[model samples]
Target: MSEAKMNPMHELSDNVAVPFEQARAMPPSVYTSTEFLEQELDKVFRQDWLCAGRSSSLPNPGDYTTMEIAGEPIMVLRDRDGSLRAQSNVCRHRMSTLLEGRGTVKSIVCPYHAWTYNLDGSLRGAPAMMHNTAFCKSEISLPTIRCEDWKGWIMVALNPDATPVGEGLAEVDALIGHYGMENYVESFCETHRWNTNWKVLAENFMESYHLPVCHAGTIGGTVDLEKMTCPEGRPAFNYHWILKDNTMPLTLAHPNNTHLVGDDRNKTYLLSIYPALLITLTPGYFWYLSLQPDGPDHVNILFGGGLAPEFRDDPEAATHFKALKTLLDEVNDEDRGCTEKVYRGLCAKSAEPGLLSHLERPNFDFARYLNAKIQGEG
Candidate 1:
């Protein structure tokens, strides 16, 4: 079979069944409507296994991280017994948010009324609440949440009955197991507020169709569009691979990460884990972006990743990292411009859905994922 014929990833004919040449893009309101955003928060973010950060970040007991998902304040921490726990960051006393950011905490204390909780979500103390017989301080605790550690990724789900993160992502785990992602160290963690819808960045990360025009000076030069291949999209995620020569600078192949063979050694994998997880894995290095939709017009990005262990110890690692950051910033600036302009155009009165390129199978999958959540089929 021809390469295109063998690819199960596109599944264009079987799933959507509309020929790519006849497929139209999603309506622009899907990106700009306030009503749709609310539905997504409830159906997508609240029910899905949202990636938090690396498990290594919370290695020690009491070490915790905090974030706001679907408007609910959440905390993930390591308890004294050395297990992971997720809980609401809202104080039980007066509903005031309990934590601001992340750190090791012996106990989570509410700044407003002095209510305190142990790392396990147990009520530690309720200062000055003993005045009334009706008050039951010992019985109150922060509402616990569901959390799981999958490989090195930490994730939490707001829904009590949500699928276990490990079981939920089992297919993805086995699909890319050769990467040895568990040992990958997170060299940097940054939060950037971008003036673009989260989906714009999400789709950009998944497709190489825009490389020649968008990253013309950098990555575009290294990739041969003809050599690019889109694998079939799995139920949990989507991936595409493109062959690049062994001489690329930013991601020169490393010894420890060389298990992939055939075109795999020369191939770079661009993967999207549904709604918000975007990862780029090469034979040498890797990085990822976990997106948080701030609103219709803004996205908060959690971006960072680095070289495999072998490359991390390189004498020139600092120099290489600095150059990578500089180059990445340029590419990011270009992407931000594209997405921001797209968002602005989405608001135009004459805006209409456009055609989908054969290269944009990822976007088609994204549209399908959104449709599923919105229609309660996923």
Candidate 2:
């Protein structure tokens, strides 16, 4: 929507730098340029291993979810044998999108042409192809996409040879394994569209500087900006940890907040897996956002979150989940204002990139990660 005002010739790379203090945030052009967004679809998102939420969301044999990555429709399904598969959601017959949202289906039946596919993507039925000997049913199948289940989170890639998400997050697992994230059961999951570039949210999630100003009514009181530590990560991810203050209502002690051996027990790690996964983990709970660009000014956010297993079964779990989701919504409302305003301001003729805060060190790290991908080094 804001595309008409963007400078097509803009190069955000010119505005960004290293040694964070010496660096500037990505220029407004990067966020509002339609040309750059198209490049991102092919260079970054499609080629990178992007997350597709949790395996637990589709634990049943036939449970499935439909996703769109870099504009490609995808079907993430669990077959009867218990293996998860990511296949192109387009049907071979007429190239129609096979599924819309998510549900348990015995088989994928095209609503338009009646072409059916098995849980594993094998063509199960063709309405009128039996007489055509040239069209072999056995040879017809949906294109398979590369997918993986890393510690219960499903990650998929359009590129046949993208880096494995498990390998990318091995160090992350080793670092936060004590949190027992595998035992974290999702109490809430949702997808919402934001009227801003995906990068806005990515950077917002990485820094602690905005908490006091943007989220003052919610998480702001529970965190200290000076305590944030942004550390470099493997090629596929970057992370920062923030010390928790005792003031916020959300920080109350829970019986399930366990397994941490030391200082980490008091800190929450905000890890952004390069390209598009954001995972926030504390001792008692975890939440994440799988960001996807819909257009230059639009982003589709896939979010998932839950508390540790020991907390979910509590009699108050339902009420607690409701409160948790409400709190999250409030935080998101604050973030939305910042991102949307920034995006709108970027479209102005006077908008220019500015210096980064030390708190934005992680944000700059992500910018470098993006630059490498834009240069084909990823």
Candidate 3:
């Protein structure tokens, strides 16, 4: 909660300026180079705690979900006692992937060989070959990964030596206590594969610079751009964007409009957990945006929204939910369209990393954070 002790490795070089005055765009290699992307998989994704799935997916014992972290197939399953456990999807014998996607399974069976593992990743069975081969069933278990469920979100880590996920995200939990995210249920979820650099998408979400240009129709009229301010002295680890209630009519009126409008105004706070997770806290709902890179120029964006318990069952709430989704979809389409073009432009030799605007302090701060991490400064 106490800011998670800012990555201690961050040290300012004499030449490096503080209170960054300008925004500098990232190099093209960051987007188009396979080499850089691979380094990211190792240096960043593997070492950081990533929001893999929602806890609701694995609510009951035996429920499981397969997730890909830094291209490694991993599975999270609920044990018989209802505790969540994560293990490599690779078979211990031949190293073939175990789970395909997500489903309930009493036990995991490897397709290549009949190597069966329990929900806790212990070897439960190896039908025939075990008798002939000097295989120790106790030692022939699937490798396990660190798994943690906090505030209804499931997080996974690839590196065995990485810091505990609870330590990394402790600050975030304390910051959103009032939201009571853990109590909210997952109302909707959707995923889209976009052709854009993952960092580009992440950086875009960290700032509101493009809102007026891209989301003018949906959120432009609804949010007040002037009131938006990125906290100073914090290096933009998180952000709070203030939005005023619609001067224009609500595109779709919400069921309980009382809490929707606060003194005829509303504020939407957008917070970006460094690296990949973005959380949008609104009066009526909470939306989570998680980005996972497929390649240097490709990314998968997962959208999850949580609704208050009372509204989850109300029919009118459904209408507002659909409206929110439509509104967000429109904004997402715009971002994807623009980022894809940015990818193309970055491929051009004439293109170079551009500077950030003063208004884009959040993006600049995020870029600094990433640059530091990539350089092993954090």
Candidate 4:
């Protein structure tokens, strides 16, 4: 299918024929399709520049970590020259698995045949293979993946022809420049496996409609849901929802956080970048959520958040951070519950695609974005 046929933005707009005050909801297939999920993994996750981990995780040379993207194991390591590199974790010879988990390794050796690769993914040695006539050491380097570090986040792209991370994120860079993310330290990180499809989680993160009912105790009281707005006309790669609370002004009184006074103090900005990255930039801290699909109906949600480095030394700041973490945890649990229920509903024979609400432009934009990419439109 052509991109234009798949992403009829004008048709989408006309079909929903209502003012912003009366927008409908998205179709339910977005939450339920196993086939659709597979296409997303190929077109969106595999093709887009995804936020994988923070540069701080590999602070020293030889530090390395492994993660899966679109079911492919990816190895990311800091080389001897202190440069970060990402490569497919499969050995060039016999396709053996090379590494697992995070650690400091001078070189990665494939357990199957002991083929060793340097941190830069170059073939360091293949002990017994040097004697073989057909073996070529120079031609056996592990396949390298594209990687870029921006504001402490390490992003990787699996597609060799994919757009550069800098170009894809140029707008986000400008939007979040004031957050000073480089000065932030990751203090909390956790992951949870869900029995729901990945799209459910992505859709949940893209819209704020459920906040008033679902997160009533945690963040609903603080967010001005009625004032929420989403990015329009641009690529559906980014979405933003703002929450302003009155207590935000007093929050600046906390030590080392005077910089977030007045208009900036109480606002919470939630942004979902296409397929699997979700970032929440708050007054004194930020949250990064990475979603990875495990199967047709399962997903891994990795969560990380922390206070800016300037506030890291204060005991009072730690207490505040803990409270915020607890609140976020509660809200996440609420989402998990809903996603599972939605998953069950999607499996029903009577299930049909739904509508899009005007307030759900973020969610609609995300669906449109997915359609474009899957159809090679975007």
Candidate 5:
């Protein structure tokens, strides 16, 4: 393709070159173009360390969860030795998918051919393969993908040389280490497909400017927008803060908590780990969305959250979680409407970029990150 045809986002490169105060939303093509989405699949999603879910989700041997990243079926499982492992979910024989959704199993058995494999992904049994001289059970094993239990998140990378998740997020750990995020128990996780570009949802999470209006029925009134801070982002991530003083006890520092004090006790962090792990970390609870592009027009989300250790065993823990989940679902519903509308507007020929607000500094940073990755500058 010619240079003009290859570069879909005329606005993206320009947005990255200017100062944050002068930045604007990415051009509509950034969200509507099929070509641009393919480029992202190759350069961003395929090469980045993608979060699968929380490590605690698969606690015992044989427990597992499955997800697709950049069109590759991946399964993260707890091996027999009590280690987290990721491998191709596709069966070697007949190329069938070995697993579906999340569950525990003694071993991987291909539903197509009844071919059996151990928890480690090594082939154990294959029927009627003796006639084939090339069949080697010893050599037939599911391809191993790079997997890491970074803090508590299960991260996997398709690119063998991708930066280690821990090293990439070292600064993040330093920023929120006192919260002991790794120990937070994940109470629920569910998958949903949304009709909006992944970037729209990501950018929404990066700012609080729309919270009061967009989340009016849920957390809108609870947020003090003036107290929020949107600073310039780092190479691997962007972050902002919301100082909350709310009725939700799980969002504030628990009585048993000693790590945070004063304003930090009610502080909430909105962290966007490029290319798509968005975390909402609080003193008492945490939630996150791990995103993947279904196409230019849709995104697949793994949404999950739970309480900090201090609140998990409280007598009212169950009730608190139920309320939290209810609130979250409402918030998500509001977000879905907003983002989908934005996408619909983008798809129109008259769509144009708009200037960013100070609260959208993280959104601007995210644009720069996408520009760098797709242009091979990162």
Candidate 6:
């Protein structure tokens, strides 16, 4: 039998085992197989430290946000003592979910039974349980999960034994730290569902090779393809950069910004954190997408962006951000169209992956990352 007729998963393993210079795009089955997706949910999503959102959004003690990781509902919040906490979002009494979306709450109260929990995941009160001799409020708190704040991003891990977020991102921090990314303020965060595999959207963000074509109507006109560089990726993430003069002034360093020097001022970094956090970081602004797989044909996305502190106080800040938001929305629409089309093609019986370009180095690394994780190498 030919290589094309071999087992799909084994073919993927062989493809990733090759070098970057000889790499091909991952097989269609990587995105189209339900069995493979189930493995990804367990090995990749469940074992990784996923980005929740910006910690700045939870400045107040009662502020919290909820998300589901590999079918496990979790909430990240600010405790009363000014600490970050991650815990099960399900109520202990009847296993009902305690929160939805984002909001401020004095205490968690399950809508189903009004079982109250403190911000620290402690059981503050449980009505009518006093009569049950078997009940002990002290031992009935929500289960705690591993949570951490790395730079500005709130990270939560479903697996207790996962590596610390900072250790894996040390190199990324060193590269982008001068910009004070931790101080960047989030302007908005919204959740949306897309009709494509999560990996499809992720691979789209990892390369700039398609920008000039896929995003031509939006921000692609400003791109100089030759000026882009895709270097070998680190174990925890993959990144690429486009060094050029930006058409949007807000994307470049502000006049008042003095920290960044030379090319750093004009650098646009595309960072893909393992599993599913994609970030576009520029000198003056940043945006990100946190992806969750719903199934082989769908993904849940948490999309957000914000401005650096230097740009926030500018006289025309509001107008600049308003225009920036509009542009990003257009870019997102273009990406949606391209990735959804790719998914449709992958579903076809004749779907086959083509050779990868030099600009797609990150995608190759991502494929390797996925393969390693799924094979229990990590």
lDDT values, one for every candidate: 0.77, 0.81, 0.71, 0.73, 0.91, 0.91
Task: Put down candidate 5 lDDT per residue, 43-146, tens digits, no spaces.
Answer: 99999999999999999999999999888999999999999999999999899988999999999999999999999999999999899999999998999999
| Model 4 agreement with the true structure over 1-378: per-residue lDDT tens digits | 456324434334343444445554544444455665677787788888877768887889889878889888898899888898999999888997789877888889999989898787889888776568988877778888998887788888888887777787778777766767767777777778999888778878877877887777766676666788776624836666575665543223235666665655556667777668888776667778888988768888778887766556666766767776776788788888888988888778786545566567776666566657766878
TM-score of each: 0.90, 0.94, 0.86, 0.87, 0.97, 0.98
User: Model 2 over residues 1-378: C-alpha lDDT tens digits?
Assistant: 254434432354444434666988787767877778887888998788888889999989889998998879999999989999999999998898998887899999999899999988899888877787799888989999998988878889998887677776789888777677777898767999999889988988888889988998988888777777877556777888887865543343365555554676567888888788898887656889999998888889998898767567778888767877888888888989998988888889898778888778887888777777776776
Q: Which stretches of candidate 1 lie over 4 Å from their true place?
A: 1-17, 256-258
On a 0 to 100 scale, what is the lDDT of residue 172 in model 1?
75
* TM-score attained by model 1: 0.90
Off by over 4 Å in 5: 1-6
Q: Tell me how many clashing residue pairs each candidate has.
A: 4, 0, 4, 10, 0, 0
* TM accuracy, model 6: 0.98
Cα shift from native, residue 232, model 2 (Å): 3.2
Q: Model 1, range 14-117, lDDT digits (tens) per residue?
A: 34556555666666667777766787888888888788888878889999888789888898999999998989989887899988767887888889988888
The 10-residue segment of model 6 with minimum total lDDT is 1-10
Ranked by TM-score, the better of candidates 3 and 5 is: 5
Clashes of 3: 4
Best first by TM-score, ranked: 6, 5, 2, 1, 4, 3
Residue pairs in clash, model 2: none
Q: Report the C-alpha displacement of residue 120, candidate 6, in angstroms.
A: 0.8
Question: Which lDDT tens digits does candidate 6 get at residues 1-378?
Answer: 576546666777988978788899999888988888989999999999899999999999999999999999999999999998999999999999999999999999999989899999899888888789999999989999999999989999998899898888899888788888888878889999999999999999999999999999988887798999999999999999997565778779999999998999989999999989999998888999999999999999999999988888789889868977998899999999999999999999998889999999999999999989888987
RMSD of each: 6.1, 3.1, 5.8, 3.8, 1.7, 1.4
Q: How good is model 5 by TM-score?
A: 0.97
